[model samples]
Structures are given as C-alpha cells and as structure tokens.
Target: MEIDYSHIKVIGFDADDTLWVNETYFREAEEEVGKLLSHYETPNKIDQELYKMELKNLGTYGYGVKGFVLSMIELAVELSNGKVSNSIISDILNIGKRMLNKPIELLEGVEEVLKTLSKDYRLILATKGDLLDQERKLEKSGLIDYFHHIEVLSEKQEYNYSRLLKHLDIKPSEFLMVGNSLKSDILPLINIGSEAIHVPFHTTWQHEKVSENETNGVDYKTVYSLLEILKFFKNN
Candidate 1:
C-alpha cells in the first residue's frame, strides 16, 4: 500500500519490542528459571508446567512482570510436588526484580530513526504494559522526550486505539500506527480505518505474535527495519 507520509500527522508506536529489547530479556530470565526447575523435573516438563501456569495467569492477572513472576513461583511449587520452599520463591522473585534492573538497549539505530521521525510527525507512544514498569523503562531509555504522549494500557484493543484517537482529536485517516506486534499493534489500527506499519521483530513474545496474516482488506504496510521508514520523508 502506498502512503503519503505528509497526511499522517500523528503516529503511534508500540513500545516494548519496537523501542527496546523487551522479550529477549524475558526469555533469558525464563531460561534461568528453567535451569533452576530442571532439578525437580526434565527441561521439557519444566517448560510444559511453566506454559500452563503462564496461560492460567494471563487469564487471572493479565500481562506484565507481576503475572509472569507469579507464574514462575506457582510452577515451581507444582513441579516440586508441593515441596517448594520460601527460598526458592524468593530467588525467583529476585530474578524478576533483576529484569527491571536490566539496562534498556535501543534497537540498532532506533534512536537516530526516532530523532529524525519526530522532526516531521507527532509521535505518541501507545504501549500496553504494567503501569509502573512501563514508566520506569521510558525514564531509563532516554527516549521519552520524543513522544508527545505516552499511554500504558492493560491491553491494546481497538476500543483503546479509538479512544486515543478521540482524545488526541485526530481523524482515523490522518493517523498511523507503527510497531512490531501484528496482534496488538497492526491489526487494531487497520481494523479502525487507520494506516498501520508492521515492523517485525526476531524474538516476539509468544502472546503477542500473530499466527496469520489478516491484513488482506486493510490499509497496511510492512518494512524490514525501522530505519527504512526514513525513505518516506522527502528532502527538505
């Protein structure tokens, strides 16, 4: 689909995978937890247990570190045949705490791209995350100044996107959503009569990855890298 960048006055972006290495860190922590739990059960068994607990937590507490950490604790208890001790749970909680302490690494050349894009468009970060964790990440990333608005929602449903557009007083046709998640970022925007740009990431969170392409009748586009978006802006 052809895009006239000039018409897109407001551009919204998904934060976690788009701006920083979010899922990779989570995956690393999970691997560590798996090793710890492997003493009680095989690696495959540990993974299966964790996956089941994760799904159960998603239904109960939704997304974010709290849910993930709790799932780890619950899985440990189950895998250890109810022999899990407070020390094991404390160690698991410490691992989750250390995740927030992990340094935020901006994707390759992402800062430069955002700096250039902000000059020409109204950039607003529309991220779905745990409120406090998301806020701390933005503060640490040092990219907060580039956004005119930042939203941390429980989920990125079409309704939330519509409400955001309404709050910003921007037309659907005049807005654009850019991010890595096909489920959270791309589909919602396309369904709402807005333009969407899908930026694929290598290590997508299992919950956020789209299983199939559903942009057949939607006004959507994809680019290999975030820097490639600069091609749309003309020389001034």
Candidate 2:
C-alpha cells in the first residue's frame, strides 16, 4: 500500500531517539542502577523490578530522568527491605545527573533532514518528557531554529494528538509525525487519522513497545534511517 505525503503541511518530530541519543542513556543508567542494587537482587531481577517501579510511579512523576531516579531509589528501598544504604541512593541520584547533563548527539542527517523539510513544510517538535529537560535538550541541540513550535507532551495518545492538531489549527490529514517508538509516535497519530513514519532506534524502552497485533493492520511507513524519509517528500 502506498501512503501519500502530498497533503502533509506540518511535520512533527519526536525529540528523543528519533532526532538524537536518548533511550541509550536510560539503558546505561538502568545498567548502573542494576549494579548498584545487586546486593539486594540479581541484575535481571533488579531490572525487572525497576521497570515495574517506574510504571507504578509514572502518574506521580510523569516522565524523564528525575522520575526514573526516584523509581530507582524507591525500588532500592523496597528490594532491600528499606535497608538500602544512603551512599547507594546517592549513586542513583548521580546517575540521573549524568544522564541529564550528557551532551546531545544528533542522529545521522538529522539537521539536514530538518533543514530540508522545514523549507517546504511547517516543522514542529512534539515530544513527551520533563518540560525543563526537553527544553534544555532542544536548546543544546542547535536544531531549535528549524522548528516553528515545540511541545512537550505528558503522554502521546490519540486524544493528545487530536488536541494538539486542534490547538495548532491543523487538520488531522495535514499533520505527519516522525519518531522511533511505535506506541507513542506511530500508533497514536495513526489512530487520530494523521500520518506517521517510524524510524526505529537500536534500543527501545519496554513501555514504548507495541505488540504485533497492535500494528497488524495499521497504515504507516517505517524507514530504516531518518534520512530515508526525504525520499517521500517532493521538495527533497
């Protein structure tokens, strides 16, 4: 089946793994936390428990490094029966700091793609994460000028995208979303009658994964690299 880009006037980009390195840092932090809490449980068990903790606390802390750090600390206490050392807790805090401070490493051709597309289409950033952290990353990315609008969403769902389109005065058919996660970036837009292109990262957070059945009949394009998306745009 062929998907058309003729009607797409606004191109929405997902900030994290789609444009630059993001999930990679979380994976590294998870490994570090796993090692730090190894005394309480095995590495695998620690990883599993920590994910559960994050899911459990998602509502309370929303998303980003701070919430992840809190989940790690809470899990450490739980796994250790509240006897986890303060030094270990401090180590987890430092891990979050390192992740938050890490330099932005843009994926290949990100700037070129954004620059080329922005010329012919309105480019907006619609990503979900901590507002402060997302803003910090955008400023550091040096790609801020390419985007006409930047939105840090609490969640990426059909309703969220619908509301965004409404607020921007964009029709569903005029918006196109590009991102790595199938769950957050692809499915929601498709569900809302907008277009989406998937550019899968090497590593995906467990929560952002979708089952095969969920994508079985979905109509969306998947490109191996961000640059490949240029082929679908007439201006490029």
Candidate 3:
C-alpha cells in the first residue's frame, strides 16, 4: 500500500460528519420530536421505529430532513394508531425545515486544514444528501470557497466513487477520499483503487457510524483528528 502522495491529484471529502458537526444537530432535533411523541409511545420505541424507517427511506429517498421528517410522521401515525392527525405530520415537516435552517458549525480546525489542503490538492466535496439542503449548508458554512468542485449525491456506493472520478476526468488510482464514515466514505473509494483517510468523530448518527473492522483494505488508516492528516502526509 505504497502511496506517492504526489500522485494524488484530486481529493474528495465527505461533508456532514467529516467537515462539520452535522449529526449532533440532527440528533437534537430528533430528540425533541421523540419527547413530543413520548406520551403516545416510549422514547426508545419512537427512536427505534423512526430509525428503521430512516434507514430504509435513505435507500429509496436519500439523506436530508425530508426522509427523516416523513419517517417521524409515519412512526407517529403508527404509534398513535391512526389518532395522529395531518397537523402532526405538517408540524414535523415544519420542524425538519427549521432544523435545516439552523446555524452551521464547522468542526475544530476544519477551516485551517481546508485552507492548507486547498493549496496542494485538487479538493472536491463528495457528500451525499438532499441537494438543496446540502447546498444551503455549504453556502452558510463559509468553507465552500476552498473546494474546487462539490458533489451532492444520493449515496456513496462504489459506483458513486467511479462516477465522481470520471466526472472529474481523473483515474481512480489518482484520487483520495477523506471522510468520517468508514462505511460510506472510506471503503467505497478503496474498493475502486483510491486511497482513503479516516478522521473519526465522537457523536456520529447511528446510521453514519461504522465499526473499525469495516475498513476493507490494508491501505486504510484512521486519525483521531483532521489536523493529524497533515502530519501523516508530511511524514509519508
């Protein structure tokens, strides 16, 4: 697993967990909804059921508050035995919209690292989520200026890695994917012959978190923080 860092021309990054504190915001919103629904169902029951719907909906509908909102509405209706009104569903949608409009917070040193990495790499954002939602987040984050290109996709499956590379007119072996989710970001790129750098986060959404054993290739490595990536590159 020799990496001539010089050969790496384009670096793709995951947006949510990798660049900013996205999951915590979502979790907070979900908790609020869970509390609101607790009189009808247990908190654990509401959370578990909604999460199950979310996982399935993501496969069909994709990331963003839309699917999550819908799942919450569906779960509420189910838990309430048809007693949940359209007003509750509408309320959930409004809440999801508000969550998207919330302020953005970049992880520590994210701007610093992006500023540094922007100088040497052809940095591209390769995040998957609702297009408009992701775009709004990027616009407000003040970090969009550092990237050369931005991709908002439905998922980061293996074909997605190839599609993004081809779209950029780069070879798979010449690209690098840096992200927090091993399941979504690291392994898919590695499968296609690209290298990956994993910068772990502490409070990942259950859907986004990956077990360490999920690292598919021998070439993959994890850093405790994003800044450690620079040291790794310098040493390598």
Please report how far candidate 2 places residue 22 from its true position, in Å: 0.6
* TM-score to true structure, per model: 0.92, 0.98, 0.91
The number of the candidate with the highest lDDT is: 2
Q: Which scores higher on TM-score, 1 or 3?
A: 1
What tens digits encode model 3's per-residue C-alpha lDDT throughout 2-116?
4457778777789987888778777887888888788798888878888898887777778887777878887888889989877777778878888878788888788888888
List per-prediction Cα lDDT, in the order shown.
0.84, 0.93, 0.82
Task: Give the TM-score ranking, best first.
Answer: 2, 1, 3
**What's every prediction's RMSD, in angstroms?**
1.9, 1.1, 2.2
1-236 in candidate 1: lDDT tens per residue?
Answer: 54576777888888888888888877887888888887798877777778778888886777788788989998998888899878888989999999878888888778888899898888999998688899999999999999999988777889989998999898988888889998899888878888888888888777776655565566677898888877776642
Clashing residue pairs, backbone N/CA/C < 3 A, model 1 = none
On residues 65-142, what C-alpha lDDT tens digit does candidate 2 reach at each position? 999999999999999999999899899999999999999999999999999999999999999989999999999999
Candidate 3 structure, TM-score to reference: 0.91
Q: Kindly indicate the candidate among 1 and 3 with the higher lDDT.
A: 1
Which runs of model 1 end up more than 4 angstroms from their true locations? 213-218
Error of 3 at 107 (Å): 0.7
